[model samples]
Target: MTVVSSVKDLEALTLTIVNEFDAGVDRVWQLWEDPRQLERWWGPPTWPATFTDFDFTVGGEARYHMTGPEGEKAHGWWRFLAIGRPASLEIEDGFADANGEPDLSQPSGRMRVSVEDLGGGRTRMTIASHNDTVEQLQELIEMGMEEGMKEALGQIDAMLAE
Candidate 1:
């Protein structure tokens, strides 16, 4: 597992996960830049993500769904707020309806992702998921956000190795 740390800071209303990859920033960047690469590891093995529309630009939206082992589907969407090539990105992530449209009933959160070259053909990726309130943060943690993300990110090392 590449995850060095997974912290849920209710004080900061953020759930942050840090991972180190045995690849350069540019190489790791492709995981997020390309929808195909992203879908390869964006969800846990039991529930794989499949992107329907991916526009990798500021203000662009990416919509996808994770199909569970039982044939159930969990929809999701991301709107890019900021994109810094090979470095950082900020996006609003949320649950979506069956049609892949934003599900307003579910809370929407902002996630900031930063990639840093650790040198020696290695890199560090820090992802901070920000919630609007402590209640919201606690709610997400209770929903197993931390564990789900850890599982989702666990597949990255294998993909990077390829």
Candidate 2:
């Protein structure tokens, strides 16, 4: 219910999801700045993420895996491109193998996360996932990235409450 809008811009080959939170910008920022905190809601309830390596600096990278209900693991990686504390970040996101090698078979994207102070303790977080081609964007959507993201973000409200 915290989501404000989720739009897919086919022309731009991007899927943009916007979320609004009742908490302060700082509180929301911590969700991404802290690896442990990020693990709390980075995946859907059915698949919880565990971070193996986290280097949250510009040019640094993070490696994580999401464990499903049946204990299946989905590996992923992120290379930070730009980071603006409590405000914005840009990263190259891709699927990886257990050994941390990129999975070239899957489509990768550049994800931009922006946090805006909407005043009066309200904050807005926008995530834009961009792929190089329309087919790549469509492929990711077919893989349930949008729904997975929605389900993943839905948990944040309770996290902020705590």
Per-residue lDDT tens digits for candidate 2, residues 1-162, read 899899988777788999999999999999988999998887766677788989989999999888766677777888999999989999998878877777888777899999999999999999998888766555444333445565567788668888
lDDT of 2 at 125: 98
Error of 1 at 10 (Å): 1.5
The all-Cα superposition gives candidate 2 an RMSD in Å to the true structure of 8.5
Model 2's alpha-carbon lDDT is: 0.83
Error of 2 at 122 (Å): 0.8
lDDT of each: 0.83, 0.83
Which residue pairs show backbone clashes in model 1? none
Per-residue C-alpha lDDT of model 1 across residues 83-121, encoded as one tens digit per residue: 999899999988788788988787789999999999999
Error of 2 at 85 (Å): 0.7
State each model's C-alpha RMSD to the native: 8.6, 8.5
